[model samples]
Target: MNNVDEDNALVNFEDDQADDLDTSLAVDRFRDAVLYGTDWTVRTLLQQIEQGNIDLSPDFQRRDAWSLRNKSRFIESVALQLPIPQIVLAERKEQRGTYIVLDGKQRLLTLAQFAGDFPDDHPLWDESRKVASLRLSGLRVLTDLNGKTYNDFTSLPDLAQMRTQFDNHTIRSALIRNWPDEDYLYEVFIRLNTGSVRLSPQELRQAMKPGPFTAFLSIKSAESVTIQKILGLSAPDFRMRDVDLLLRLIAFSTRLSVYRGNLKQFLDETHEFYNANWGVEQKGMEGLLKRLEDGLIFLCAAFGNERHVGRRYKGDNFESPLNRAVLDVQIASALDENVRRAVEEGRLDLLGTFQKMSINDQEFAQAVAGTTKSITAIRTRYNSWRAALEGVIGQPVQMPELPNG
Candidate 1:
């Protein structure tokens, strides 16, 4: 990826102020959680996984991040009766006994894959396939166990005792039940996962709000050549930043009037509602996606594909990294029916108008850069672009009314 693509892939416009809320309130909310400690033997945990009592949500970030060597080392640790970090699970309220793995997913998955008992239809099945009946490697102590799989132990009497020890090895687990709500659970998940191997906000969003709408975002993002070109992404972004941009476009275009400056909450609510009612709202969502794609295609054709969403000042020889704020206003304005027709009819110089504003307009520049997540900044970009387009398009340009807050 070029610098532009790399920058866009890491863009996150959510207001940091949202994260600065009262810590005392947050701590109080977490106090409502009911948790208990227990231990599960390797065989029992794998059995739970096989029986569908434990859910390793497919949308989990870095579900298969562990390498074969790392997995082997973990298995070796279990065989040696070494202490392992406790896993955290949340009991599903809807399905009493069933639980969702909140942390230590890779560890549990490693255990199952090495035992050659991982379910083929599992969420991590594709990654697990590469290490099924995983042969031990990179052993520091029991070097003799190298190159041997779990199945090998069954036929080799010398390794039979080791196999038994592995199966009986108990792992400590913290099971959380009777949470206040999914919101609370989501907070818990965020707190738990924000350690050394942290998940990005988009990753957490996708994992916390899995459903048809989430699936739709992934599929549409992968399929849209126009989106890929405009974002300079040759493939879907692993960090899900591409999807985050798409979500922003959808939310601002369709529900801008409802936005109240909390970008994260706004996006989260949108995901929750649409995911819950996807069957009824699928068609409308698809139409919104198509509109955004059409706007993107037009921008790409008017400006070079690589320069369309990038920022360029009057004196700058090269376009700056993709400006997400520029992306927002440009796409939103391009979606207007009158604006599109004007450009198509050779009446409006869309590219020239965009260049003039980007190079000369101080307020617009700041709106797209500094304090971008603020409601005022968001409104400034849209209103400023609307005025600029109207000046050239020779007519009023419609834009969504933003909230005062």
Candidate 2:
């Protein structure tokens, strides 16, 4: 995580261009703009949901991020006729005019559960069933309405006014047309959420860009027993730090030299490259997955835990970057399909070689020294490990020609 210097941050800014811009200029640049509209009332949105026009199951920031207390407060906000943040959605790639919520899943979920099961006639409502009524739990402005559910408004004698207020409330929205070639919606989502420190880099990418590559990584990590054995994730770490660690292996191993030392930029570029061909390049993604799987199986066979992966600190925790840098280069250099299989299925033992290299390797030491984030450090550490891996293989391994992206 190299910090961008101050001089570099304002490099894209311009002070003299404010008056020269035109509406047509923006429209021309964003000619791929598909379904651009905003300002929908809650009633209009609900009608769309009921008519089977809206998709509530888009990959969200976090499906279960809102606690009951948070949901309760949100409901209260809507009930009070307050303006909520705009919800954004993208037209589904597979279904024309069908849309998926990009930004406001929690808000929509709370509304659906409160209003009762997406009206039962909606298409997604059956597959994505609403659980039950969510009774209001918290109230700052509407204290008297703290415990009411939507059902109570219809049947009860005293609560009719509250129902009308809730149903008539408005929430703004933005819909992006799912253009074929350009990632207009994805880029918009990234720009909108970049300032949020609440999300991790991978989490944001996974949510913003969903495809086979993302699905593959999630499934692979969930099913890997060996990975869990190697690096037990810390409790309360919901940011998918473990998955990112494995991804670090693939990204750096494949393109070690092209790495410019900024992890956010590196990962952002890598994800864009992978996501660009979501449906059209499934075969390529599968091949990449195969190489990564081979490397993972090989490494697990060679090492036991985090201690074997990186420098052990005095506090007993292992340094993750050093561990990852070493693994990335080692696996990348020897990940020729045949070599990886030989190490994994051929019962080769390189524990002694790795153990000795870990202790005596000067480049490994330099990799973690200074800021483990610079290009110099990345190259040194990865180069050192590549050499170490080659020594164990009893042959010089060739670095693969890889894309800059």
Candidate 3:
């Protein structure tokens, strides 16, 4: 939850959909619930327990697989005088019996997952620990404010007697419509998923990527299996965050930066670019990748020779500027001239030496702290490095590629 929430902002799913409902007359009533009232999805809670993942016990293999400590905190906070998530009907109607969950899957799932009616893995399902069961037990369906009480599904008069008769209470039914289309479903999913634990765009990208990518993960897992056994370790965490860095690098490398949408779209466009350009002929992308790889390799060589190594390549911070030089190479390449001159000349190595040179030989022992590093100085240093790299690599520096007029 903590990891997922960092990059996303909360979206009010209920408020957005209040005006759009299936029924005309019930619109205001629904609006009242969406706007001022709360109609807890009785069905969602029931479904959650049925899904069989509410085991808080440690021994349970599936206990909090998604790491929902924040969710527990939110629920506890709401219960024990903390600000609760404002009830939002982050759900919408589609066809029937299956509502398009607009914004509240996490909350609904939490409710169902924490309902203390049954043991973690209850047999016979006898003890109903789901929220629906708990909510229905003392079910005094809060009636509408104007006049009548037993208005909608909640305020039925016989529900009290029904609860008294049975040790359990269940919703008679829910009034929601089902929706198809994964994209539409995702929109609803995202809209409804609004909360403090708002998922990152990359997280959403991971969740929404289609079969091939998912299969790639599985294949990678199998490949990593032998590696783990040999090394007695696990795979590295290189998901959307890494992808974001890679995308920026690629964008900068390609000298194109217009395609900015969700992670899915970004990746899709990147893949398309590779397929159309690199994968097909190996002329454009191959050169780009090779130049990037060689530049880094040359940069590393220069760094080692100059006794300035070990700093990792951060794509955005350092590589972005270097990408400008790459764009320069691309321009030189278009002109059919000496390209990749920076890498050939070991410009980055010179820059690294320059940076190290700025600090005292005694102060070099200290980490990169208490130093005023300016962008202009960095650029100047890069130019110095570029001059050196150009001298060594013998490639002409060029600019970013633009559309031919």
Candidate 4:
């Protein structure tokens, strides 16, 4: 987190696995999308953004991660009349003529910030609520423009022509107006964003499905000290990987009965459902998060940090990076009142039992590694962990019955 090297060392559980099962269907679905290209001058685009015709979703606003230097360089490129990449936009189905940004968010935001006209409510703003003006720096070609801001150009007669050139610079944009549904639009967004800096699926989902539930996930993930410690993160992940793991916990713990093997679809459905019904479901979701936190804290106290959610197989010297499947079942089982009481009352040696199982259980080991998103793997890990806990607790530990598929 604070140390760049240590932060880079944290492992992602699903890095090797495919997010979704079917790709041919997605390709077939997108074939019908109606897309057209247009060029918009910087002046016109800024006007649209100011008039609220262009929608920068809350998630996109949160991910304005470019530094001031980066923004200034981009402005320098515009000043030099360098070619810029095209942006992609999808028309909002609910509000005609208004469009949501699917790509080039940083570019657009940089333009607004450099022009000293970015919205004050935008997440990029500091606590002072003042619009940040970008001063050009690190310009190789336009070296004389360094330290100059848009306001400086307005005030200085010599810089007036340079400001006009920047305003008249046109950037190409591909607009999709007739998408069948949000799903198709999300696919388009994902495809458009496959550049040098690729977005994680959860990041895309956050942008596409912004609502109370998504906000809850982000806030809770950031606030949870236990989760941050377990994951070895000093701060919230830039790509929202921490949020992705928390979503897995919430989905499996609350909606296991409806899971049908596809982790991506299941998580997406959970987001959509909770977002749509957050008014009534907020309290229940809050309870779930509290239970998860309690479970995590108990595990840390009992087993210490290294072995909290890390996986170790037979003959292994060190624990593997935090395993999503292991975390899911362990935390879910710990949420049971009986299991917690048994462990706290000294009737059960939870750590010893877990270590024995980790060293000897093949089914459990396989379920936590390799391909873990399938129905068989999920059920195996949950049921196996529940059985292990039940044997130690001397009582039945309740778990949701997953689908047979």
Query: What lDDT does each candidate get?
Result: 0.73, 0.57, 0.33, 0.74
Q: What does the lDDT come to for candidate 3?
A: 0.33
Between prediction 3 and prediction 4, which has the larger TM-score?
4
RMSD of each: 5.0, 9.4, 15.2, 3.8
| Model 3 regions lying over 4 Å from their true place | 1-38, 41-69, 78-83, 86-209, 214-241, 247-268, 271-392, 396-405
- Give stretches of model 1 more than 4 Å off: 1-27, 58-63, 66-85, 116-149, 153-158, 193-210, 222-243, 294-326, 334-359, 369-374, 392-398
Better of 2 and 4 by lDDT: 4
lDDT tens per residue, model 3, 1-405 = 232222221221111122111112333333333222433333444543354422112111111223344444433433333334443232333322233223334454444544434454553133323323322111123222112221212456654442232213222222322323234334433455455433323333333332343323223323332212211223322222223323334554453334332324444455445544533534554456445444444434444521122221332223111122222222223222243344354443444433443342322212122221222322333344334435644665453333221
Best by TM-score: 4
297-326 in candidate 2: lDDT tens per residue? 666656655335433222334344234555
- What candidate 2 gets wrong by more than 4 Å, as runs, is 1-28, 31-37, 50-52, 58-62, 92-96, 119-132, 178-180, 198-327, 330-382, 389-405
By lDDT: ranked, best first: 4, 1, 2, 3
The alpha-carbon deviation from the true structure for residue 193 of candidate 2, after best TM-score superposition, in angstroms, is 1.8
lDDT of 1 by residue, 277-386 (tens): 89899998888888888888888877765555545444444354455667778888788898999988999888788878878888987786645777888888888899
Best by lDDT: 4
Candidate 1 residue pairs that clash: none
Over 4 Å off, model 4: 1-12, 21-23, 26-28, 116-132, 135-146, 192-198, 225-233, 300-303, 306-322, 338-355, 392-395
